[model samples]
Structure formats: C-alpha cells, structure tokens
Target: MAVIIKHNELEYAAKESAISEFALLTGKKQSGAEKHMKYDIRMLEAGRFSFPYHFHRNSEELFVILSGCAVLRTPTEFFEVHEGDVIFFEMGPDGAHQLYNHTAEPCRYLDLRTVSGLDVCEYPDSGKINILPEQEVYQTGDQVDYYQGEAQVRDKWPESVLEKSR
Candidate 1:
C-alpha cells in the first residue's frame, strides 16, 4: 500500500527525528550521508546545520521550504531562502552545496535525494572526502605537498610534545 504523508504527520516526524538523524550521519563525516526514507523531511533550529560543507558527486538534492528561513551555503557563496521557496541542487561542480538554519525559530523543509550509486563527497575547507570503503580519500591544501608511492617524511616539530608525559 502507498503511504501518503499528511501535513501534520510530516511536521511531527521532522521534529522527532531531526536531532537523532543529524547525529546518525557518519563515515568520515565529510562525504555526508543519506537520510532514511522514513525521515525524508528535516527540521532544524537556529545555529543548526543540515550537513557539513560537502558535495556529492552523484546524488542531487531538492529542498522545499515549509517555514522560517535557511541559508544555503555553497563553496563560493550563500543564499537566504524562506518559506514557499523550492530549489534543486544538481550533481557536478556547480551542484555542491550545504544548508544552515539561521533564524531564531526552527526552519522546516522537505529534503528529497535521488540515489546515484555510491558517491564520494569533498569538503572545500578540509579538502578531504569521508571516503566510503570503496572511494579513495585525499588530503588537499597548500601547506602539504602531494607525493606518490610509500612516501616518508620527518616532521620538524618535536614528536615528544604530542605524547602525554607520565
């Protein structure tokens, strides 16, 4: 039987699972996650984040604003979205994005994601993918130079300082 989610039910469900669902996201943390179909909608409060700054190479994200507002933060910029707003984030370089609830009141929204196989995500600031068991993860930054093969390096900083003195 097909289940039709009513307006009230959706609101209740979002609030009930919002916190737990957000915390359930794991695996490297950078690549983000897929919310279970049961909790397809998410409601967040001020200072709450939907996901870390990451981009899925495969899946597309869709959002329908239900109440309050949120700031959709992208790699290069951000957009302030409010109720009645409908938006879709595609997959690719231009599609990478994350959203944040910045209003005093909780912002409720519908998040719909299409499964696009197993995808690797990248964090712009961290420059690392929470690589799944199948995907390769890499570190990116100006401070660290890339190397191939079994590279060896000696840190100039004292290794002794990192250990706890007994």
Candidate 2:
C-alpha cells in the first residue's frame, strides 16, 4: 500500500528558538509511519535558520527543497539551494549542516532520515554530543577511558566457590 499526503494537508506548528522561527510538519505522527525512516517538512521564515550545525553518527539524511530558496552550510562549504534541489548528508562530522532562509520569502524543505535504535549527534560549535533514544547530552571532552572504572580481579573464581562446584 502507498501513503499519499498533500503538502497543504500537513499541520504546521511553530518552533521558536534564539536563531530561528519556523514551522514543522510532524510526518511520523501524521502518516502513522514507522520502521525504516522518518520524514519532516520544515518551513523557515525569511532570515531564519532550520537548526544548529550538527551531524549524526548512526543515520544518513536527505533534504529536498520543496519551495523557495535557502543557504545551506556544510562543514566545508555553503551552497545556495533553490526549489527542486536535493541534498544528501552522510553520517559523520563531514556531514554537519545548517540551513538558513536568506530570501525575502519563506522556504520549505523535506527532511528525511533513516530510523535508528540509537543515534549520537555531534554539535561541533557547542563541543557536545547528543545521545538519542536516551536523550543524553554530554561534552565531547568529558569522555572516560573504557576500562577506567573496572575493578581488578586477581583470579577467575574464588577458591571456595570453585571447590563447591567440584
């Protein structure tokens, strides 16, 4: 079966932040979509940005410009994208991106991504990583070595326990 939804039918909700004012189409809820991927439509007002510069560790994402124009910032470059443009972002630091609507009118784009049980997102500018599903945010520099807290074990099993098994 196929799911069909018109853009006009999408319910938009305001998402306010320090750097942007936008509306988001909650596709998962609207379509009752689950499993492989998730979709969202982000509508950004002129001079507003979509989100912070960040990259995912577990999933890739694709963006398609639905209307108007915007400036897209990747780790190494900035691109002026217009309607019908499609962009793919791989999972990594190299894929970090931010989209800003610099045109005088609003811009809309589809944000699609793979669904993952766990996702780690890195925010380079903030020196933080967001662990999803658990929704924990931690400073990148605060990592502890893997075995840092393990207690030293001198023997594989205690003598009394081993004797009882024998």
TM-score to native of every candidate shown: 0.61, 0.83
Residue 49 of model 1 has an lDDT of 76
| Residues 1-166, model 1: lDDT tens digits | 3445555534333222345424212111121334432125566667777766777776777878887898888757998999999888777657777778777887777777776457767777567875543757777553343565335433544668646543
> What lDDT score is found at residue 25 in candidate 2?
31
- Candidate 2 lDDT tens digits, 27-106: 32355656788878778778777777899999899999999999999988998999999999999988899888888998
Best-matching candidate per lDDT: 2
The runs of at least 3 residues in candidate 1 whose Cα sits more than 4 Å from the true structure, single-residue gaps closed, are 10-39, 132-166
lDDT of each: 0.64, 0.82
TM-score winner: 2
The positional error of residue 60 in candidate 1, measured at the CA in angstroms, is 1.2
Residue pairs clashing, model 2:
none
